[model samples]
Target: MPRKKANETKTYVLDTNILLHEPLAFLSFQEHDVVVPMTVLEELDYIKDSKKDVARDARISIRSMEDVLHDATPEQMTEGVTLAGRGSGITAPSGKFSIFSDLELPEDHHVFTSNENDNRIINAALYLQEQKSPGQVVLVTKDINMRLKAKGAGLAHVEDYRTDQLISDIKYLSKGYHTFEGRFWERVKSVESRAEGRDTVHTIAKNILPEAYINEFILDESGEFAGLVESINEDSLEILDLGVERLMSRHAWGINPKNVPQAMALHALLDPHIDLVILTGPAGSGKTLLALAAALEMVVEKNMYDKIIVTRSTPEIAESIGFLPGTEEEKMAPWLAAITDSLEVLHKNDENVKGSMNYIMEKANIQFKSVNFMRGRSIQNAIVILDESQNLTASQLKTIITRCGEGTKLICSGNLAQIDSNYLSAVTSGLTYLVEKFKNFSGSATLNLDGVVRSRLADFAERHL
Candidate 1:
């Protein structure tokens, strides 16, 4: 509902991908007649053959459009939801250039597309604008640079194809690479800082800064605090220790993944009273395995919860994965390996446990679900583990967490720094988003796992590489 000048502009140009991304974008221009801008249609010609999912998704989209267009029929194509190309009987607006108006391409930025196509798309809008001056013609594209180009060409109006995105702002976070060299980092409960120096620091900053090394001693990865920020304080790092009884309890989970930090995280998570735990670690940290094991034990032996719920983002981009070469179980062998490996170790340590988790799997006592099916389901009295939680967007993460039912405890674990998609980075991922936003709330604790315990070689690769 953005308003532009009441000038004569009346036509909206749909970028080819806009239709493919949203698939239903064609009908969105109902308030005005939309121009596919002949050149935009041509762009689809090539994508029609792409070997990627986006390309396949594109094909499905174009076909859907065909129905809409055909259903409208030539009669309907002319005035509303019509199919006539620009310059047809509708009269080409002023300043409008012929289809795909020829233009010189800038060598640097124009390297990807044969400027032949992009320029024409731009010209289509320009042409419609000129002829229908004051008619309000604007270009809608998914490309950030493309939007900038439209502005540079004097077509100041443009918008993103928001089909795949939700508009909202979340604070950005930094991925600090600290070695935790004993002397430099001490886990404390609180710290204090003053206007001037001296340990007698008197101020009530309290444990306001939960992740700090000390109250007044703020430092970066280099162990110094004077570079970018100046805050006076004594902060606290609340630490909880779990003894062997708690470790051997029916609900206990000893993480085998090679990260020493899980030892601390396991302690925090084992406390039945603390219902929510967030674990963030690098790729091999074993966050998922630990959560899964805890969930299994809590269900099987402790009778702590009715079942174990596991979920992760679909990683829509990684889908083909090709069917596994084994039986249905074997096909998912690779994906299930992580979960099973964790279970194997859990059983190894606790002789009281026996058999394949097949009983749980067959009975659906332990549910392995994709993030796609989690909508609107209220999960209760269960131990829920949201694996690869970093891959989730802030809103998606919030949605997943809100699904937890009463007596349900949810654990979100993933390395914010290890995201596989460009749409979101460490600073903006849901994992870090949760850490920054929910840090101080009681009954909620987060443990940053460092020290790769995967193996001598694994540790070496993690630290050196």
Candidate 2:
């Protein structure tokens, strides 16, 4: 085998899951040779015909691979086709791509079953290692078990595909709220306070402030004070008084704030200036309930928007029911059960006012939509609630957010710890991504509800189980 220099090209063997996780992952390895194990291709073929997001990604990966190999001859492909200029808008790199149809396994390798696809892929990587110099062949996978198996097979290098991970650790994710120490109200009132219409705006010294972002919730260390950051500069900071009294008294539809975080969420939800709001917390934390209540209040009572659009991503809970029957709304009812339950709660005490749950739903003008059909449509002057957003990928989040037109307010609520998508983790979830990306934006806010108000049993389970 020929030994390459320190700056020489390296080969990355991609797992099928990596390509499914990111369709364009091949373009990320700049100036490195990429190998597609034939077994990986076989797995992709098996999954390409499904109606799931993974299937769509597999199709896209197949197309990208085809486009890259369009002009390469069979001999050239075997000899490693140059990947330079193959990716759209990507700068050409001195790398190559080839399909590893051959397999080579060590004589003593016995950790993995020979019939398993994962083992076959690992064996392909082992063959590449044998063909290339030591430390030049690396196996890239998102599956932890597969990486462990590769290491057990005596491979030199194995790593997780981290190109799409925005945050490396879950602990560092933004909590959307911060607490200040040392007489917070005294410090805030001492600088400057003025009434801007019904809201009071307060200015604070730059030195006393913690690293705050626009619209981020600011609370006193005692948990009695709450305010929203209006603006900030190097010299000073301005925060709009959240008026805790007003928040506590404010009733959306029929729901009231049950906790401090819920109060902050309601304030952000009803604020006319804020266009985006994200609520993240544990289950039974009143995230979806608060968002729905506020959305109804805005659309029905205040007439701030035309209607309410409710959508969510449905990654199968256990086993998929498969190809639901009926109209769009009917087919989506199972997934929209949460919205329906919230509606029932909102209308529970409104028997005299609305008389029927269907009437109240109609009066609210709520529309249930699936996340799949949201592309290429512009949602204007509507409150779009994306529940269970933790199941969405970053690319899917971008598509949904971009669909928001003028006068549209988007509210995304999800429990990051309850994510169902295998491709998404707490740090890489769409909800977390939005929190990190929109933390500094003036028209956006986030709330992480800590209180679980569902019931004593639910709270106990959340804490213990």
Best by TM-score, which number?
2
Best by lDDT: 2
Per-residue lDDT for 1-465 in model 2, tens only? 565563477899999988987888887887788889888888899989875656778999999998888888888777788777755555555588888874445555434556789888888888778778754899999788888989988899998888777789988888888877854766654578899898888898866676888888787867566787789999788887775576677778778888878888888899999999998889999988899989988987899999989988876542233478877767778888998888777777664644566776788788888888787899999999999999887777988999999999999999888877765678767788788888989899888898899999999999999
TM-score of each: 0.53, 0.88
| Cα-based lDDT at residue 88, candidate 1 | 32
Tens digits of per-residue lDDT for model 1 on 1-465?
575454643567777767655555655543355667656656676777864334644676567566556656454553445333423343432221112222432343332354466666776667667767767777888666777877887785787654333223322232221233333324333444443432222333335344442111222344322111123235423212222233233235444333224544665566576678888777666676677766765676678788777666645653433443544334444554666676676557554444545554544386666565576899989888777788766656777888987898888888766676534555546677777666545556676666665567877887888
Candidate 2: which stretches are off by over 4 Å? 1-9, 79-94, 102-113, 185-190, 317-322, 352-355
Clashes of 1: 28
Q: Considering summed lDDT, which 10 consecutive residues are worst modelled in model 2?
A: 102-111
Error of 2 at 64 (Å): 2.9
After superposition on all C-alphas, the RMSD of every candidate to the true structure, in Å, is 11.3, 3.6
